[model samples]
Each structure stands twice: as structure tokens, then as C-alpha cells.
Target: MRIMTYNVHVWYDNDGQFKLQEMIDLIKLLKPDLLCLQEITKHGLTEFVKQTGFTKVFKYHSVAILTNIENVEELSPPSNTRNYYPRFATVKVPLGDGKEFFLTCVHLDYKVETNRMKEIKQIKKHLSCLNADAAQVWAGDFNALTLEDYSDVVLNEITSVRRKNNWEMPKNDVSTTMKADGFECSWALVDRPPPVSTCRFDTHIDYIYINQDFRKIFEVTKVEHHGSTASDHSPVIADFKLIQTDDTEEESGDQ
Candidate 1:
């Protein structure tokens, strides 16, 4: 399956132009089987569904999960706290005939690293409560750099920029926390240089991560940035191939 995570910058481009139609067109062109979006509004969601024909959708505030697949089930969010609602959502998606995987999408707190870390923990807690052993994929705008992307040179540049803008210091706590909890970044599996910026900030923040168990089922064949001028952040797309099955390992996959 081709899964994509995109932050629409609230339907505006990097140049601050509202490109609702362009956004819809871009999604059509990409044709992701499972699409997760951040910074999306209600109006945009409605128009996207109408024009793109995504039959199933789950929206929580600005974040949403859109899929055209049938018989997939939407999972319930944790009732303990409403703090993460606006930025997070999840669904149980079918893998094949009788198998399924949990897919969670999130738009973490953008301002502070600590806040983003807290949100990651909340997501992990919620997912653990649902089912810990299920294959899982979590993707969307994390708004914080991963520690692996923070090299000596990149760290210097990022820190200088943040300090000058009076923004909080850059930290990898959010992605690190997720990594510690058993999630593996899809981008990391592909052989590529690090620190490819997803947003205008010149920092790599947007991501797609799958748990180790998911890796056992699907092989990440490709991961790339589907950049579009219509949005500030490029869509991170990952292609997966089913590596093992009860009958035979098959290459059948879709976007």
C-alpha cells in the first residue's frame, strides 16, 4: 500500500496562497490508499471528500485520516483526556483477506518540544490501551526533528535559527520518545541522507513510522517526498509490499 502523510498548512501554500483546488488536485495526482493530513479545516475536508471520492474518513479537529478502502473500522479515542483530540486520530485498516493493522495519524504540538513529547506519550498510551501487539503505522506532522537528523552541523544551523526567532530550542525528544516505544521511522529504512526538510522551516519534522511488528508484515520498498508548491509541507509517501502471508508472500499493493 502507498500511505502518505501531508500537512496542508491549513489549505495555504508556502507563498501564503489559498489553493483549495490545487490541494485537491495534488491529492488526486498522488493517489494514496491511506492519506493522513494535518492543518486541515472542515471546509477543506468536505471539499476533498466530495471531489477526491475518499469513501471513509475520520476527523478530529484539524487532523484527519482518509481512505477509499471498504470494511475498515474506526477506533475509539481514549476518553481519559481531550488534550490530544484536535491533533490526533486513528483507524483499524484492513491489510488483506483476514489481517488488519492499526493506523494512527497525528499533528503534534508545534511550539515546544516538551509539549510534543507529551502528545507522543499520550498517543502511545492510547494505542497501548487498544492493542499493543497489532501492527501499527503512525504518521503526520510531528513538528519536531528526530535526534538522528540532528547532526553537529545541522544542529548548529537549527539552533541558531530557533534562537534568533525566539523559538524554543530544537530537541529530538518527541521522535526519540516514539522510537523508544518500539516505532521505527519509514524514512530511516531507505538509504538516503538525513535532514530533508518537509516544511518551510528547513527542518525535517513530518514523518511516517511503523512498529517493528508491522515491519515483519510489510517491507518499506520506497519512501520519498512528494513535494508540491500548493502546500508548505511536502507529502511523505511510503510504499509497502506484503512480505509474508499464510499462503504466499505477494507483491500486490496499491496507492
Candidate 2:
């Protein structure tokens, strides 16, 4: 499975110019099975679906999902916290073997950390009502930083990314979201290093996470984040191999 998440910087270039084609071309080059896009405008939505010809497209306010896979149904976010604009979208994806997984693409409030925390909590709440028992993946621009982020770029890294000394349950929304029963950061699963920066701000905010149920059945082969002239936020890509059988699992995976 090739999964990607990006915040297209409101579908504009740095000089306040729209570079929709460049963004489209970049996505075409990646050709991910599932794409989670944030900060997309109506124009972007129209252009992407037209160009990609993806079988199903799900829209939740500004965030959108572009996928060629079939059996994708758009779901709703939590109504209780949907007072303001929706920061995320809920989509169910079928695995083709009588299995399905819920994917929640999130782009929390970028301007404030408190608001992001509130929104993330709501996202989890909404997921709880859904069939979380099956595989689940939450991918997008979290905007929430880890404790390792001491730079002023982010709010002292609101969450705990990982334990340096001993294992401790993190209190930040990132940790809370992953600890919600059976989730783990996707980047950590791979032996390769993830891109250092995901956007012009040099902040690695974008991410992809799959639940524990997929750990044994899946292996992340590659993860990369690259800058793009088309948008301020860089593109993030993660390629994975879903091994269903023991013999097929031994096949060499993408590097």
C-alpha cells in the first residue's frame, strides 16, 4: 500500500500564486493508493478529480481524499465538536478480502495548539463511534509537535514522540491518539529515516499512522518528505508491503 499525506499550502505557491498543475504532476508521479490532502480549495478539488480520474473522492470541508481504489465511502466527523470548520474527514476503505479499515485524514487548527488539541480529541471521539476494531489509519498534517521539538517553530513539541530513557505514556494528543488501543507511528516502523522537513518552515509536521493490527501484516518499506515548488507544505510518501501469506511475505520488499 502506498499512502501519502500533504498540506498543499492552500493550493498556492510561495508568491501567492496558484500552481495547481505542479501539485497535480507531483501527485501523479507518486501515484499513491491513498492520498490525504489538506488546505485544498474548491478549485483544487475539481482539478484533482478531473485529472487523476480517481474512482472515489471524499471531501470534508477543505481536506480531501483521492484514491483509485474501490469500495471507499465517505463518513462524517464528530457533530459535537463540528461547531467550526471541519479539520478532518472520515473514510472507510475495503481491503478486498472481506476486510475494511477506517481512514481519518486530519489537518488540525494550524494557528493554535490548544485548538489543535481540542480538534484531535474530537477526531478520536468520532473514531471511537466507528468500527475501530478493524484496521485504522490516521494520516495528515498533525501540526502537533513532539516534545523533542524545542525549537520555537512549534509549541515546545506538545506531545511525546518517543521515550528516550524509559517507556512512558505520553500525554500529548499525538501519543493519546496512537495509544488509543492499537496504533503506532508509521515512520517508526521502517528502518529507513523519514524526511527531515516536510515544508518550507522546516517542520516535520505531516505524518501517517496505522494501527497495531497491521503491524504483523504490514511493513513500511520507504518514507520520504520532499519540498515542492507547487505548495508550501512538502509532500510525504510512505510505501508499504501488506503480507497476507507466509510465502509471499518472504518476497523482497521495496527499498
Candidate 3:
């Protein structure tokens, strides 16, 4: 399966012009089986969902999950929030042959680290409530960087940037997430360095993460950037292979 995550910056081209056809063309080139987008407008998504090749689509806040297959729906119940758009979404994705995984696509609060952390917790809690054993493929614009992304002293750069921006590093939250079992960034799977910039911010912050239980079940064969000028942030395209049944089920059978 090919999976991708892109922050379309509200579906405008880098020059700040509306680019529905351009965006559509870019997605076609990526040819992702699963795609996640952030910072898109409601009208933009509604239009994209209509024309994009993906047969199933779901959007919440400014985030969207697009898949080539059908039977995609929210993993958790919808919330009645008082915002112009929904802010979070997780979809039950069909992976073929009676298999599936939950893909959570989110555009976290960019202004406050604390707010983003709170939302992340709420998203995880929602997933747990829906299906405690659910496998996850998390992707989005995290809006924060980690100190342990396997880049030497690039670790220091994360802290330095946080200090420069005068935002307190959400240490406890970052540790909790990175330390979670079955949770690994897709970049770490391959030997190449991570993207230099995920968006026009000149920093890399977008990502795709798979939980521990699902990591062994899928193989991330390629992770690379797509369409340099399509959006402010470059879309990350990943080719993955699911080699086995869910580890949880396989283990239960072994016992």
C-alpha cells in the first residue's frame, strides 16, 4: 500500500492561488492507497472528496483521510465542537482480505503546544474507546519536533528551535508518544535523512507513524517527498507492504 501525508495549507498553491486541478493532479501522481491532509478548508475537502480518485473520504476539523477503497468511516463517534471546522478524524480503513487498521489524521492546534498535546491525548482516548485492540497508522502535521528522531545533534536543533520560538517543549507528551510500543516514525525505517522542510516554515514536522503491533505486520519500503511546488509543505509518499495478519491476532492464535 502507498500512504501519504500532506498539509495542503488550505489547498492553495505556493503562489497563494487556488489550485484544485493542480492539487488533484499531484495526488494522482502520488498514487497513494491512503492519504492524509491537514489545514484544508471545508469547501476544499468537499470538492476534493468529490473528484479525487479515492472512493472513500472522511474529514474532521481541517484534516482528511482519503483511501482508494471503500468502507471507510470514522473510527470514533463524531464530536459537536464549536469551531468552523472539525479538528480531528480517525477512519476504519479496509486493507483488503478481511484486514483493517485505524488511520488518525489530525491538524493539531498550531498556536499552543499544550493545546496540541491535549488534543493528541483526546484522540488516543477516543481510539481506545472505539477498539482497544485497533491497529493504527497515524499521519499529520504534528507542528512540533522531537529530540529523538535518530538524527545526531539534530536533536539539539529541536530544542534550539523551540527556544528560539519561545515555546516550552512538551517534554512529557513527546516522551510518552515516542516511547509507546508499536509506534515508530516511517522515516526511521529507511536509512535516508528526513526531509529538510515539511512546509514553507523551513522545518520538517509532518509524518507517518505506525504502532508497534502493526509495525511488523507492514513493511515501509519507500519514504520520499512528492511534488515540490504543489503545496507549501511537501507531501510524503510511503510505499508499505502488509506481510501478515495483525500481530495481536496472530499472537492470540499462537497461544
- Best by the TM-score measure: 1
What is the lDDT, from 0 to 100, of the residue 15 in candidate 3? 88
C-alpha lDDT (0 to 100) for residue 179 of candidate 1: 84
Residue 54 of candidate 3: its Cα lDDT? 71
lDDT of 2 by residue, 146-196 (tens): 544334444333223333433232335664556665776676566436455
lDDT of 1: 0.83
What TM-score would candidate 2 get against the native?
0.81
The alpha-carbon lDDT assigned to residue 233 of candidate 1 equals 91
List the candidate numbers ranked by lDDT, top first: 1, 2, 3
Backbone atom clashes (below 3 Å) for every candidate: 1, 0, 6
Pairs that collide in candidate 3 are 60-86, 61-86, 61-87, 182-211, 182-212, 183-212
Model 3 TM-score, 2 decimals: 0.81
**Residue-level lDDT for 193 in candidate 3:** 62
Question: Model 3, stretches more than 4 Å misplaced?
Answer: 81-86, 150-172, 192-194, 244-255
Estimate TM-scores for all models.
0.91, 0.81, 0.81
The 10 consecutive residues of candidate 1 with the worst lDDT sum are 246-255
Scored by lDDT, the top model is: 1
Cα deviation in Å at residue 215, candidate 1?
0.5
Candidate-wise lDDT, in order: 0.83, 0.73, 0.72
**How much is the lDDT of residue 34 in candidate 3?**
83
Better lDDT candidate (1, 2) = 1
